[model samples]
Each structure stands twice: as structure tokens, then as C-alpha cells.
Target: MFLADAGVPTVSWNLLADLQEMWAYPFMVNAFRAGAIVSVVCAVVGWFMVLRRQTFAGHTLSVAAFPGASLAILLGVSTSLGYFGFCVAAALLIAALGRKGRDAGAEESAVTGTVQAFALASGYLFISLYKGLLEGPTALLFGSFLGITTGQVTLLAIVGAVLLAVLALIGRPLLFATVDPEVAAGRGVPVRLLSTVFLVLLGAATAEASQITGTLLVFALMVIPAATAQQLTARPGRSLALAVLIGFASCWLGLIAAYYQPYPLGFFVTTIAFTGYVLAHLGRAVHDALGRSRPRGRTPLSIGGAA
Candidate 1:
């Protein structure tokens, strides 16, 4: 009884009804659950990464996951094991090679770039060697929300909780070290130890996010939200909270859009995150310009007194 019906509902399209329909499926529920954990963890760690200028290091760790996953597939093992193992190893290597001292920036960049190059090559090599009709190549690069299991969701939750707890424990000293490493070290803060711990946490976060966004697009979750939040605020606490909220909104909206559309989930997520970042930048620019345009002082009162 619907005109030109193409499986359209007879009742008016309602937002609540649409949400209820989306939540009716078990897979969607699992997807949302996993996504929530991933978003929170990535946002928190990513805020630190941004503050410390560690985006390149984070990207290298993410690239490391590709080789890990591909090697896991080649060895017929659980991909999660490979993801965590290789990423952690790569993090250690980077931390060791890039010690905290003068010229540390150059050393870190060189080491991270080398690791990323080798990781990419290794991933492709594994792919080429993978016989027996390997599938989900696209899923490994981009991601899919359809096949997320309850076990995977539980694993994500446990890992995310541990990471959050660790971050909370070290949050104060870590912030001090990040803001002024030399001063913090002089004041008895173990800057080197904190650096090592942070890198390891970043690696774990990259691996965890790769499960949902794949290795290539992991930055979509980590970098974009944090960068957008930083653009909007200078206060550390507010920026961190904003980043988490932005990540959560992006993930949920991306999931819903992917559910109704024919594209990959990663595409929607990355696009939405990128859009938020762009908007934030624009808003900041406008705010700055307006502030500049406004006069500063009591010039009118001086003129009236003179008159």
C-alpha cells in the first residue's frame, strides 16, 4: 500500500525507530560495544600522543600491526596475537633507538621511518606468500564491523580498561614530563621511563584500534579527534575530554551510516573524523580573526574626557 515502494516502511521515518532497528541485531550490538571501548582508549592515548608530538611514532606502530596481522594469517594463528606481538616489539625497538637526549628527534624519526618501511614490505611479502585463498585483504586494510564477535568485544574491553588504568596512574607525572622534560627530569621525574611506558601504551592502543579500523586507517581514530580537540581548546583536561567525546560521536555515527549504506565502516569513520577536524580548524580560525579585529582598551573614554 506504499507508493513506489522499495521496501520502505509505511510509517513516517522516525529517529527512535531507526535506532531501535539498528540495535535489534546482535552483531550491531557487538559492534557498538567494541567501538565504544576502542574510541575511549584511542582518544585518551591519542591526546597524549598529540601533546608529546608522537604522531609519527604512533603511525609507525600502526604500520607495524600490518606485518603482524599478515604474518599471523600466513602462520595460521590468531591475528590478535600477531597484532599485539609485533606492535609491542616495534615499540620497544623505537624506544631503544630513540633515547632521550640531544638529537633525539632526528634519531626517533629515522628509526620510526625505517621500521614503518620494513613493516610495509613485510606485510606485502606475507600477502604474496599467503597461499590457500586468503580472504579479507580489504578488511585488513579498511575494516569491517560485520564479523566482530562477542569474544573480541570482551577482549577489547579488558585491554582498554587496563590501558586506561595505567594511563590514569601515570597521568600527572607524564604530563609534567611531556610539558617540560628537562625540568621534570631535574625535579626527579623519570622522563626516560615515562617515555618507554607511553610508547608501549601507544603500541597497544594502535593494535587495539586496528581491530576496528585496520592498520592503515588506525590514525583515523587516534589522531583526528585529538587534533580537533586541541584546535578547540588549550586546557589539557578539557581537550582530553573533548577528544573522547568526539571519538565516541564519530564511531557511533559512522557505525549507523555504514549500517544503512553500502560502503566500508572505516571510510565512514575516517571521513566523519576528518570532517570534525576540518570544522574545528575553521572555527578556531574565525575565533582568532574576530579577536584580532576587536579593539583593545578604553579609547572612547579618553576621547569623551578630552571633549
Candidate 2:
């Protein structure tokens, strides 16, 4: 009868109304706030992580967070503390080992793999020690929206602020080092110190991002948006800003979709971000192909990221 009435709005209108109702709940409100914070933090740190080709390191840190949160459950301590502690510790270890490793690229992969394996083992051990309680680690691994509290939102904001500040202090030198470490070192930039500092920042960022995206889905928020933005632009400033926009949109939209649907938030977030990346890649490929017919030779891709 309600559907038959002329006064009744369409399904789209019902969806809009439901969205408003979604905000009425405190948990949903907190989830949105937390998602925004996580998106921004992940975008900034992740932009640099991708630029430096340290995606493996970032993945290792995310894996490391699993054990940290699990251990916290075992000890009945705050999971955030465990997350930050283990991630930072892993970052330091990776940094230290990278310096001593024979081939920089190959060693980074080996070290990251080793760390990831150990972390997963420790996580399983802790989860097993937790007796019959499964929800704590499950939330850390898969994410939970309704469990997000106002205090967690505030903490994410504060951590995000500190991370951004530190990045601002080191961004220029870090970028130079990332682009050409030997040249940056010749120009008097402390390449090694900056590498260590950046790794720590990456760890913190991974931990913060995991709160929203979960450890397994951290790449959705941290890498996919940043990578997509980089693919679309060579200018560093535009790329960073675009990454933040993409991440925020993905996170927010994912949250909204998860609210209305019966599926997982991480799945929606990953799907949305991945879809954007694939579209960008296809558009760029098509554009290049069309441009190539005008010239006898293939058009060259831009290798250097412009300031």
C-alpha cells in the first residue's frame, strides 16, 4: 500500500533516508570518524611507501600487527599498544637488517618474508593460548565497525596528526633519498637515518590503518589508493592529495555499503579501491595506445616523479 501511494519516494530516496538513519547510531558515527582518520594516515604514509618501493616492508608491518594484537589479548593489555609496539619493533629490525644485508633489494624481500612468517606463527600461538575466546583477534584480523568507540577515534586522530607532522619534517629529504639515494647522499642528505625514520613512520601508519581496514586488508587503504593516484599523476603534490581523496572516498563508501549490506567492510573497501586502480590502469593504457599511432616509435612512460 505504501509503495502504491503517489506520496511514497523511490528506492533511491529510501536509501538516502536510511543513510540519515545510519548516522543516528553512535557506533556508526564513530566508525565514520575513525574511517576518515585511518584513510588520511594511510594515504600519506602509504604514498611514500609506494614511492620508495617498500610495499613488502609495509606488508610485513601489517603482518607484524597481527601478533601484537594477539599477544595483547593473551596478556589482557590494550591491543593498540601491542600493535604499535610490535610494528615499530619490526620496523627497527628490518631497518637494522637492511643495512647489513648483501643486496639491498633481494635482502629486503628475504627479511620481510622472514618477519612475516614469524609474526603469523606468533599470532596463531597467542590466539591458541586465548582458550575459547576468538572474537578479539578476529576483530583485529577482519575488522569490526560497531565495536569502534569514540576514544579510538580520538586516538587515531592524534596518532595521525603526529605521523603527518613527522612526515612534513622529513618529506623533502625522504623524497630525494627515495628517488636517488646515492645522489641524495652526495647532496648531504642523511639517507640511512631518513630510511630508518621513514620505516618507523610506516610501521605506525600500518598499525593505525589496521584499526580500520584490519591487518589482512591494510593494503586496501594503504597501497591501492596511493598506487592508483600515482598511476594517474606524476606530480608528487597532486598524487598525495589524490591518494587521500581516493582513500577517504573508498573508506567512507565502503563503510556506507557495509552498513546497508550483510557483507564485510574490508571486502567492500578492497573491491572499491581495486576497481578504481584497474580503471585507471585501463584508461592510461588506452590513452597510451591511441597516442602511439601518431608516432613511429612507442611513447615513453614518465619515470621520474615531479615535485
Candidate 3:
């Protein structure tokens, strides 16, 4: 009945009316606002993470947010506090343990894996210790947009703004360091400090995104869009813009789908994001194949004929 009234098209189509209906509900409005902010922040931060090959570290920080949220519930505090605290601590810890330079890839992975393991275990422990309802556990893992408050939306916007501002300030130097650490270091770029700062920023972004997509599905918001953009473009600025655009589209579409369907927002968001990524890869593969098949330079006989 509501869907019909919203002009969602059972047998007929009404795009403007459908959009107006979706925007009519306050909760949906808040959801869209929150989703937009989360998408942009995650896209920007995830772009740099992909460039630096720090997906593992991003995953670890996201996982660590689970323990933080659970612990916050146990202590009866705001879950956001827990998310930020745990993620930032984990980021600093990872930075401290993996400071042996970029060449120490194995060591960094080991450190990240260890942190992820402990964080998961600790999250379960917190869950076990909680005597209240188990619903919070599910929400922490899968996420919900139905009951999102205006305050939460405002908070998301604030955090997104700050993260973007910081990224703008250090984006160039960080890109330089990520591309060639040895050369960047030789040029006095404060490679280690920038790395540490970037990790902390990643943690912050992970924590913020977890609030929307949940800890388990953080990659949906952070990784997929950025990876898709990278697959589609080699230019950094264009890639970043494309990543943000993809993220925004995924979030909006996912929210609309979740509004009509009885499913977790994270599931919809992740599926949409994954679909975009797959399409990007397919397009790239087709383009590469076509390029290879096209003959480059004229053959000797053709050149002689032309002469």
C-alpha cells in the first residue's frame, strides 16, 4: 500500500513521484544524508589506502571497531566513542609494530593479521559478557538505516568534513610517499610521519564508515568504489573523483533498494558496490583485449606500398 502510494511502479512508472516519496520520510532523509557523508569519506580515504596497499590495515581497524562497540554497550556509553577509540588505538598500534619501512610487507601483514585476530576474539568476549538483549550484536555487524536520527546525520557530516579537510592538506605529500617511499624520503618528505598520520586517518574513516555499513561490511563503503575507480582510470585525480561518484551512487541506490526490500542496508550496499567493481573490471578487460587486437604500426609490405 505504501509502495503503491509512493508511486514505486507495480505496473506503471513514475520517477519523480517515486523520488519524492522516498524523500518524504524523515528517517529516509536522514539515511540519505548519512549515507552520502559516509560514502564520500570512505571513498577518499580508501583511494589512498588502495594506492598504499594498506587494505589489510584498513580491515584490521574496521574489525577492531567491533570490540569497541561491544565494549561501549557493555559500559552503557555511546557506540561511536567506542568505535573511534578502538580504531584509532589499533591504527597507532599497527603503525608502531609495522614501522620497518615499506619493503617489510610480510612483517606488516603479520602485524595486521595478529591485531585482527585479537580484535575479533575480544569482540566475542564483549558480546558474551553482555547480559542484555542480543539485538545490538546483530546491528553492530550488519547495520541499520531505519532509525537513523538527525543528530547522527549531523555527526556524520561533521566527521566527513574534518576528514576531507585533513586529506586535502596532506593528500599530495601522502601520494608522493605512497608512490615511491625511498625517493620521497630522500627528498625529506617525512615519510614515516605521513604514514603514521595516514593510518590514523584511515582508522578514523573506518570507524565512521562502520557506523553506517557495520564493522564487517566496512569494505563495501571503503574498498569497492575506490578499487573500481582505480581499475577504470590511471590518473589519480580522475580516479579519486570517479571513486567518490561511484560510492555516492552505490549508497543512494542501496538506500532506495533497502527502503523497498526487507534487508540489511549493508547487504544492499555491498552487493551494489561489488557489482560496480565487477563491471569496471570487465570493461577494462574488454578494452585491453581490443587494444591488443588492433594492429600497431603498418606492416613492411604496407609501408612499401604506401611509398
Candidate 4:
């Protein structure tokens, strides 16, 4: 069975030779290009999402991508269309329906959870409605690199660039709003508009990530690397850069591993990210235990947050 599932005929002794062989194919080249774009975009957006404590909303958007792709398969259209369209629409709905005020977080969670449940049901329904076997989009549920094209790579690059530019334009205020919304509002920041805009951007990022990591495992890129980086460093810039590095490494290594073996790509990606997170957590714990010579300023878990 191991032999049956191998993508390459044999393991090679030479690392550079194996890498050269992996990159020799146009499909592999496109996969790398797309993965690079997705990794950077998702990493940046995910860092802010984590800081804002909006991971539940991000998870909902990722889940929403599934039904979108499912409907596209039923309509015989591009799955990318379904992925983008549904995620954004669901985000708008969540933003609109979720209550505002002191209880906003609790209300938003309820709305996000409801949308996630409905999205899952709709995806299954779309799958069941297809008369023939749903082969194309189904392969993407667990992630695959098959049929990635230069055009798709170009599209991903354009989307990634746009996301980064928009984020740059609003990074400072968004950070203020995220860490202390009340104070940000008192300082004349448009907290509500920023929240809505961030949610939409998050949905777009989630959709983009789904193309590489798939609908079910999109959080592997969207959350794990950012969370791991936050665990290691509290500084926003360092954490953001570290998240991108972690995400990029995981994406490239997972692609290489999947190229050598025929196992599902999402499994490799998620496992690598998860392992990094575990290691970071352990290191943080050890550092906390060994330091007691002088009193150092504590890094707050979050604003007014306890361990």
C-alpha cells in the first residue's frame, strides 16, 4: 500500500537533485507559487484576527467555503467562484446579524456558529444532489495539488497583493481598534466600520487559503502559524513576520513531502504547523519557569487578560 501510494518511483540520495526533479514539473511550480501567495496573505490577516479574538469568525468563514465550492460543482462552474462568493456573503450576514455593544463578542460567536452549522448542512446537501460522482471538488476537501495552472497562480498573486496593500493602509488603526476598541473609538477611530471591513478581508483570506489547504483544513494556515508566533513573541511586527515564516515553511515543506509521497497534502501541512505550535508553547512554559532573578515586566496574555 505504501508503494501503491508513492508519487515518485524511489527516494533519492541527493537533496538538490530531488528538489530539482520536484520543480521540473509545471504543476509543481504553480503549486509553489500559489502556496507562497496564500501563505503570506493568510499569515498577516490571521495575526490581526488572533489579536482581535476573532478566530471563531475566521473558522466560520473557512467552513462557509465548503458549501460555496459544493454549489459550484453542482452548477459545473469554477470552484473558486463558489469559494469567494459564499465566504464573503456569509461574512456580511454575520456582520449584519450579530449584535453590537458590550456583549458583541458573545453575540458574534453565536451568529458565527449558526452560520457554520448551516454552511456544513448546505455543503452536504449539494454533494448529495449531484447525480454523478462529485470527483473534482471532492478531491479538494482534503487538499490536493492536481490541475493547478499558471492562471490560478496569477490570480492568487493578484488577490494576495491586494489584501496586503489594504492591510497596510489600515494596520495601525486596526491594531488600536483590536486591542482597545473603546479607547480607539474615543480617539475617533471608526471601530464598527473597521470591524466590518476586517471581517470581509478575513473571509477573502479564508477563501484563498481554502484553495491550497482545502475547506476542511484551511485553519492550518489561517490560525496555527499566527497563534504559534503570538505564543513566542508579543511584539506585533515580530509576531507577524514569524507567522509568515512559519506558514511559508509549512507550506513549502508540506508540498515537497506530498510530492514525494501520495498522502493528502493537508495532513502534512496541519501536522507541521501543529507541531510548531506545541513546541512554541512548551518553550514559553519553560522560559516562564526558569526566570526569577529579577522582576521583569509581564507580557499580558491580552488586554486585561489573565493566563
Candidate 5:
């Protein structure tokens, strides 16, 4: 009966009802816009993250942001500010502690793990300090996209633009460093400074994406598209473009799906991103099977990040 009655009026009713309702809401518009911007930032930075094997860092930073967000909630302040604060602190800590490790990846993972535990504990303590006094921080942790405001959208736009610009300007040098740190240093590239700056930007993006997708799922944007792009290609520029496209497509599609379905948008968006990655990997496997597979030498170290 539902299918038999499905006509112009039926389709129009869904459009005019769910479609119109979501579009008519300002928060939805802001969340969608913010998500798009954050997706771009995440995609670009993610290329370097994967290249440098910093996905661990990205994940750690996302989890480390909890205490700051909780503290902000306790103080009745913007959770984004708290997230940024925590990320910056954690970023610096990771950079400092990982400076001399033979395995930067292992060191980073350790630091991130420590921060994650402490941040989670602190968040709970902060929540207890103000028991029953405010809205639950779980929404911030799990994301409250429908609660995004115009001010947040503007902030996301500004930060995202600046991050993208820096990535563009620093792309070549950053890549050089990531691929071969010894060679980059021999060529007088400020590898240390670049690494610090890159980590900071990654932190910022992590904070922003966390606000959109929540801490638990922020890695979907920060890691998935970039990882998918890497599986698809070894070329840097092409990978960046592909990752951005994938990220944006996932976000927009997920948003639309969430608008109609009775589920959280982040879950849908991450599922879409993960599916894209799986499909891309499968496609690449088919491609390799069809072609003569020559190793592209040792996989070059990434300057910024992808996968």
C-alpha cells in the first residue's frame, strides 16, 4: 500500500516534510556547513598523518580532548575551546616526549595512551564536581551536531581556511621531511619546526572534527579518507584530492541520511566512510591483480598525513 500510493504527492510529502523540516532549521544548515569544512581540513591533514604514521597521534589527541571538554562543560564555557586547549597541550607533550625515540610511533602511542586515561578520569572528576548542575557532556563527546550554531560555523570556516592555506604553502617541504627526514634536514628544511606546526594543526582539526563527529568517531574523517586515498594511489596531490572528495561525500550523504533516518548522523557517516575505504581497497586489489604489480620502492614517508 505504501509503495502503491508512492507518487508525486508521496515523494513531495517526504520532501516537503522531512526535507523541508531539516532545511528550514538553522542548526542543521550550520552543522552541515561545519561538517563540510571540517571534512576538508581532516582530509588534507590526514594525508600527512598516514604518511608519518601519526594516525596513533590523531587518535590519542581525540581521546585526550575529553577532560578539557568536560572542564568547559563544568565551567559553562565553549567545549570547543576546551578541546583545543587539551589538544594543544597533548600535542606539545607528544612532540617533546617523542623527540628522541627510535620508534616515534611507539612513543606517541604511549604518550597518547597516558593522556587518554588521565583525560577520561579528569572528565569524570570534573563532572562529579558539578553533579546534576548542567547538561550531560556525553552529547559533546558523542557530538551534538544538531546543536551547532552559526557562531561555531563561522569559527570552523575561519580555522579550516587557515589550516588549508598552511597545508598548501607547506606541502612540498612537509612532504620532503616526511618521506626522508635525514635528507630533508640535510637540505636545511626545518624538520622540527614543521613537525611541531603540523601537529598543532592536526590538533586543531582533531578538536573541530571531534565537535562534529564526537571524539569516539572523529578518526573516521581524520583517518579513513586519507587511508582510502593511499590505498588507491601513491601520488600525493592526487591522493589529497581523492581523500577530500571522499570525506566530503561521506559527510554530506551521512547528513542527508541522518535527516531522514532515526539514527545519529555520526554513526551513519562513519559507516559510509568505512564502506568507502573498504570499496577503495577492494578496487585497488582488483587493479593490482589486473596489472603487473611492481613495488613502488619502500613506501615513501608522508610529510603531512593521509593513510
Candidate 6:
């Protein structure tokens, strides 16, 4: 068949040969799955991240994960495991430290920033301590989908499912807490605990995402989609759903572009995500303009973006 002739195996003989061939490879299949699962989790967690104004936490946990990854490489273990372990530890530390003060302000974030810097420096130092320590040592921090294995894909699936469940179980309470912490506390919503839980999940999500996009570009996976959706729709549920869709689209498209283009995969994904955010902003502007030129007291489509 055409697919076989084009070096791709497909159930349909007449399918696009080159594209089918790409999927015939296990590595490609694993990369696609891992990237997809991680993208969804990141998008979901990122919604709260934006609402709670905790993008800094996302950034903090990612860099703090570096030391664990570096140590994993030196100790002959999976970098993902190392990264997860380290971030969890840091999350616990942050929670404890932040709880000590009555007023949680820039001070907590400043401490997180300092920890992040220390972790990054430690990672670099560990890497430099040994020669030929890795095949592509930097890939742990920067990401390389080309290197994903089936086992890693399975691991991502498990982690993604667990994270999604946790997010769903606490979604409503978290939303309430994020929008109005004082009210949530007054209503006995365990505001502090909720905040800590969110931060922990965010750290885990960041570690998973960083494996594909690197620590530097994890924000694309975490922040951009939710942010774009918020700009387009004002409602929490709608924005969250749209953010997931946008994040998924960006992942698949970025993967394809990375497959074909010479640039790093993260670059393509980041560009697409940024573009989506921009378009959303523009769409908001147009909506405002049309509303202004309408009848008095016109009912605008509730920006809530939900059905």
C-alpha cells in the first residue's frame, strides 16, 4: 500500500504515507502522548494559577526542581522522579514558611526566588562535577521530545490522571478561595490549606511540563492557555474549558512544527500560545467596541464565557 511504500505502517493503505510513517515509530508515539497529557494538566492547574496571582509560584517550583534533576542524572535515576521529589519538598517548605507569618506578601515569594536561584546553581555545579555525565545533559532542563520513551509516557499518564482527579475534587472550593480568600475563610473553607494544596499541585504540574518544554518555557504550558482563555471569556468554567482546548491545540501544533522545523519545540509552542493570547485580547477589544455602538442598557454576552 502507499503507507507501506512510504515507510509508514497504517491500517488504511491509502492514508497519507509520510504522516503515517511518523506514527509507526514508537518514540514519536510516546512523545505525542506525553506531551498531550502534560499539556492538559498544566492548563487546568494554570487556571487557578492565574486567578490566584501565583504565576510566581509556578516559576519558583520549576527552578527549584533543577537540583533534583541534576542529582538524578548523577545518581543514575529518572530525572522526572528527581524533579518531582525535589519540587514536593520545596512546596512543603514554602507552605511551612508562609504559614508562620500573619501577612503573606512579597516576602514569601522573595524567599522562593532565593531558593530557586540556589537550586539552579546547585544543578549546574553538579553537572560540572562529572564528565560525560549525560548523553544530552541539558535536555533535562530544556526538554527534548525526540528522546521520550514509552515508559516515560506511561509515567506521565499516571501522574496526569492523579493530578486531574485532585484538581477536580477541590476545584470549586479552590475557585471560591482564589476569588475571595477572606470570604472563603469566613465560610470555613480552609483557605490556607487550599492555597497550600494548589501550590503543591502546581509544583507537580510544573515538573511534568518542564520535562517537555524545559523549566524556562513551562510557563507556556502553564500560564498562556489559561490567560488567553480569560481574556476571551470572563466566566470561570468557560475560561477553564477554553484554556484546555487552546492548550491542547498548541501542544499538537507545536509538536508538528517541531517535527518539521529546525527550531526547538518549545519555541513553536510558545509562539502559538502568545499568538492566541493576543487574538483573545483583540477579540475583547472588538466586543467592547460593538457594545459601545449598541442600544442603551443592552445585555452584552456575559463575558463569563460559559454556556
Colliding residue pairs in candidate 6: 8-21, 234-303, 235-304
Cα misplacement distance, residue 160 of candidate 2 (Å): 0.3
lDDT values of the candidates?
A: 0.90, 0.88, 0.90, 0.89, 0.82, 0.82
Across residues 101-184, which tens digit of lDDT does each residue of candidate 5 receive? Answer: 367667667777877788778877887897864656666566657778899889889989999999889989999999999889
lDDT of 6 at 283: 88
lDDT digits (tens) for residues 1-307 of candidate 6: 2223544332345547756766777877887898889889999999889888888878888887777788887788898888898887778777767742455757678767777787788878878875767655556656678778888888889988999999899999999987878888889998888878888898899888988888778888899999999898888889999999999999888987776555677888899999999988898999999988886843456534444
- Lowest summed lDDT over 10 consecutive residues: which window, candidate 2? 1-10
Residue-level lDDT tens digits of model 2 in 83-162 = 89999999999988874324788887888899999999999998899996656676788777877788888888898999
Each model's TM-score? Answer: 0.93, 0.90, 0.93, 0.92, 0.86, 0.88
Error of 3 at 85 (Å): 1.2
TM-score for candidate 1, please give it: 0.93
Residue range with the least summed lDDT across 10 consecutive positions in model 4: 1-10
Q: Candidate 5 local accuracy as lDDT?
A: 0.82
- Candidate 6 whole-model C-alpha lDDT, 0 to 1: 0.82
Ranking by TM-score: 1, 3, 4, 2, 6, 5
**Compared to the true structure, candidate 4 yields what TM-score?**
0.92
List pairs with backbone clashes in candidate 1.
none
Q: Model 2 scores what on Cα lDDT?
A: 0.88
